[model samples]
Target: MTLAELTAAQRHRVIAGTFTDRVRATKSWDAAAPVAGWTARDVVRHLVEWFPGFLAGGAGIELPRGPGVDEDPVAAWQTHADAVQAVLDDPATPGRTFANPHIGELPLDQAVDRFYTTDVFMHTWDLARATGQDDRLDADYAELLVTGMEPMEELMRSSGQYGPRVPVPAGADAQTRLLGFIGRDPSWCPS
Candidate 1:
């Protein structure tokens, strides 16, 4: 099913599953990633470290702690993704509200789906590229995201979440346009 056609839980499962596959496939946690100074391990670390506070602060939902990324990137990511899935799977979570100073209030599921799950999806490419694996994103979903974000480019850049858009060829594929819009060089590789 298309990303827009999936429920929030299903969306997270699909996107996070791709990221988990990349995490498991990684052979070098310390390898430099496409994002300037970040390593493969750092990609997982960013997902693991950032979301818990946002979840807790907004929804009062605390994710269980897992092994450090330095110790085991696979286990660390698995734990974090599982915890997020559990929250999504919880029956009560659908009705819950998530509110924080920054984004105000949104359904807990939408908040997670919009912010955390999508982050995992994008970073899957980072982890994959860092370790020389398949780095292609789902083209339809990439198109969907780029289409949705195009109107918000100025705000997205101002938020410092996205960098200045990089130029890509006019006939570039959806994923290439997405990477360029997000300030990622579509052809990046570890040195």
Candidate 2:
């Protein structure tokens, strides 16, 4: 379904929650891939860092000052999660705006779903390798990955942002293929 087709509740319940399930598993061998100097705990902290900004004023929040409270690193994570859940619960907040990278224009609801779709989908492996949980991927999500990203593979790879492609095993599942293409070492971690 196109992004406009989904509701805020669905975005929060299905999409965002799924991302939480996925990202909560990520761990880095060096303990900092998800965020500088942070492990899996730190990665969640990172996503939580930006959670509140997704709803902007939709959460009935004053704009948080600065990049948030960095000293209390885990607090930023907790606050962001609570704020994101609040946006999902409030029907009036769908049209809100969230800040993000290269996402262009979109309302709060769409952005929230997109955040779940893009970040969680890819990071499923980032966490897998970072923490060594490759066998634990959600199979259902892996199947839909092609619909979400394959057609634009060449374009994304050519942009120098996604980087040179990695070859996929012949006839592998879509998730493995997509992860390999996006500069992740499907067979090795932290390459």
Candidate 3:
């Protein structure tokens, strides 16, 4: 099945698994990442730090806290990812409602899938790039996200969640276009 066709649980398993892989492969937590002023650890830090509060506020779900990113990024990510996966895996969670002021209400799983998991998918490239690992993302999924976000460009830009879009070459590949859409330079490498 296409990544977009996967159930929320299945999608998280795939997207989060890639982030987990990048986490495991990370050799320098302090390495400079593609995001301006964010370290490799900050990539994990952003994911682990942001989602729990969003989940709690929206769905009343509290994910377990683990090692601090400063202390151990790998353990921090593993704990956070495992907690998120467990929530998705819970039989009781699929039907839960998530209510947010900005986005209104959605099924808890869909909320996580739409906001949190996609963030993880994009940040996977940051972590991988920082660590000098393979940074390729699923092309189909990248195209899907860019197409979905293009219409929301103004709102997203105003939210400050993304930076200004970077320009890519004519007819750039899906992944490259995605990187640019998300305000990352597809050609970025650590200095």
Candidate 4:
């Protein structure tokens, strides 16, 4: 299978896994941090909104430009995520040319899974921090990122690409380091 296909499947698994893990851990909860900062709910909310924004950027499809954003966070998430998933499921649907913040002219298929799946993997880190679910991510996800980044060394050099420069624990394994590389603090918590 192509890299896009492989990454797409991996992304689905990660997204599914995240939902499952969160549902298992907390049936319902309030914000992760205080009103001033992001809550666990906010993270999911962002994931939901991100679908359309990046997809639009990637697929070159445009939605009816609405107001800045919906005031009700919950409704906003449900609407965008549902639409985003539907469009992505249709293979015939072509993603547009996107000038991405990280991966530059990311192709439609690559952009499709990259944005979604990477969110899957990264948000797992977010959820872990939000709820204090402190078990490291699975190795397969880390491998995808490791191998994924190696080929794109030039892109990885960009600040927006590959993730942030958070330091990994010296003795930590690949997964931890990968998470750290991608703007997540494995030891992150609400301050």
Candidate 5:
């Protein structure tokens, strides 16, 4: 499938995942997420705060700022998600250039796929795990991400976007391997 098609599919999954997480977050926003020190509310907040910049930088479109998660987590996420979806849906956005610090100038669709799309997919797991929802990542998708990211692992780690690698068993599943590669422990849980 084309990058836009793939990203659209990923976006759908992210929206569904966020919906599920939001319901769980209502139960307990203070619940610890799989990510160190971040609560379930923080999981949604992170997306709210970061996605706009990524979409703006890649699509070259200015988006109006919306409510912070502290103000209204669900509305904040929905607003950002809708804005990002609008940008992704725009026919004129694909061929535009985005100057990324890590990858230099790249086509808008390519940048979104590499940077933002994958982030949504990965963080879906964090939100799910944080809120006692199903956190099992799709193994096929994990493998695809691993293949795309392995070559740039050093650069990504050095950029401080990812933490130190967590070792997994040799026979671990694709999701476990992918999590380890991204410096997340597959076995991590809130104590």
Candidate 6:
């Protein structure tokens, strides 16, 4: 699939996962997620806080920040997701050019796919783990990400976007290996 198509699919997964995690978070918003100190609410909060800047930078459109998760987690996520979806839905977005610190200037859609979409997908796992939901990521998507990111590992790590790679079992599943590549231990659980 093209990167745009992949991004769209990934976004759908993110939306579904976010909504699912939102429901789950009502029970334990303060529980620690797999990403160390971040809680279930913080997982959504991080996305709500960061996605608009990414959309604005890629689409060259002003997007005001919305309520934070502390104010209202569900509302915060819904608002942010809707704004991002609108940008992704726009016909002009694909053709627009945008500059990214990591990849420099590229088509807006490509930048969104590379940076934002992948983040949402990966963080879906964090939200799920935090909320005690099914956190087994799609193996195919995980494999694709692992392959695509291996070459850029140094750059990504250098930028502090990822932590030191964790060791995975030799026969670990693709999702396990992928999580390990991005510095998350697949077996992690909240204490």
What are the per-residue Cα lDDT tens digits for candidate 5 across 1-191?
43234555355445445554554456677889877889988977876777667666655578766787887777777776666666667787676888856578887766766677678778877777777777777667788888788898888889888989899999888888888888888888877
Model 6 residue 150 distance off true place after TM-score fit, in angstroms: 1.0
Question: Tell me, what's the RMSD of every candidate?
Answer: 0.9, 5.4, 0.8, 4.9, 2.8, 2.6
Per-residue lDDT over 1-191 for candidate 1, one digit per residue giving the tens place of the 0 to 100 score: 69888989999999999998898888888999988889999989999999999999899888999999899889988999999999999988889999988789999999999998778878888898999999989999889888998998888899888877889999999999999999999988777
RMSD of 4: 4.9
Question: Residue 117 CA error for candidate 1 (Å)?
Answer: 1.0
Per-residue lDDT tens digits for candidate 3, residues 98-147, read 99999999988889999999999999999999999989999999999999
**Which pairs, if any, clash in model 6?**
none
User: Which regions of candidate 3 deviate over 4 angstroms?
Assistant: none
Give per-model TM-scores. Answer: 0.97, 0.62, 0.98, 0.65, 0.86, 0.87
Off by over 4 Å in 4: 1-10, 20-36, 62-80, 94-107, 150-164
Q: Model 3: clashing residue pairs?
A: none
Per-residue lDDT of model 6, residues 1-191, tens digit only: 53324555356545455555554455777889888778888888877777677667655677655777897788777776666677667788877888767567887766766676678778878877777777766677778889888898998899887989999999888888889999998888888
Write candidate 2's Cα lDDT for 53-168 as tens digits: 44443333543433343444334434555555665577765666655455566666676665544554465455545665643444455555555666878766675656556788
Q: What C-alpha lDDT, on a 0 to 100 scale, does residue 50 get in candidate 4?
A: 59
Error of model 4, residue 147, in angstroms? 4.5
Question: How displaced is residue 72 in candidate 4, in Å?
Answer: 7.2
Task: Give the residue spans of candidate 1 off by over 4 A.
Answer: none
Task: Rank by TM-score, highest first.
Answer: 3, 1, 6, 5, 4, 2
Instruction: Give the per-residue lDDT of model 4 (tens digit) for 1-191.
Output: 42334545444644645654663474334536322366767766656665666666655665443223334434444455445555556665444455676567855655766667666566666655666665466676676776676566556657453444568767777777776666566666566
Report lDDT per candidate. Answer: 0.90, 0.54, 0.93, 0.58, 0.73, 0.74
Q: Considering lDDT, where higher is better, how would the candidates rank from best to worst? A: 3, 1, 6, 5, 4, 2
How far residue 101's Cα lies from its native spot in candidate 5, in Å, is 4.0
Best by lDDT: 3
Report clash pairs, candidate 1. Answer: none
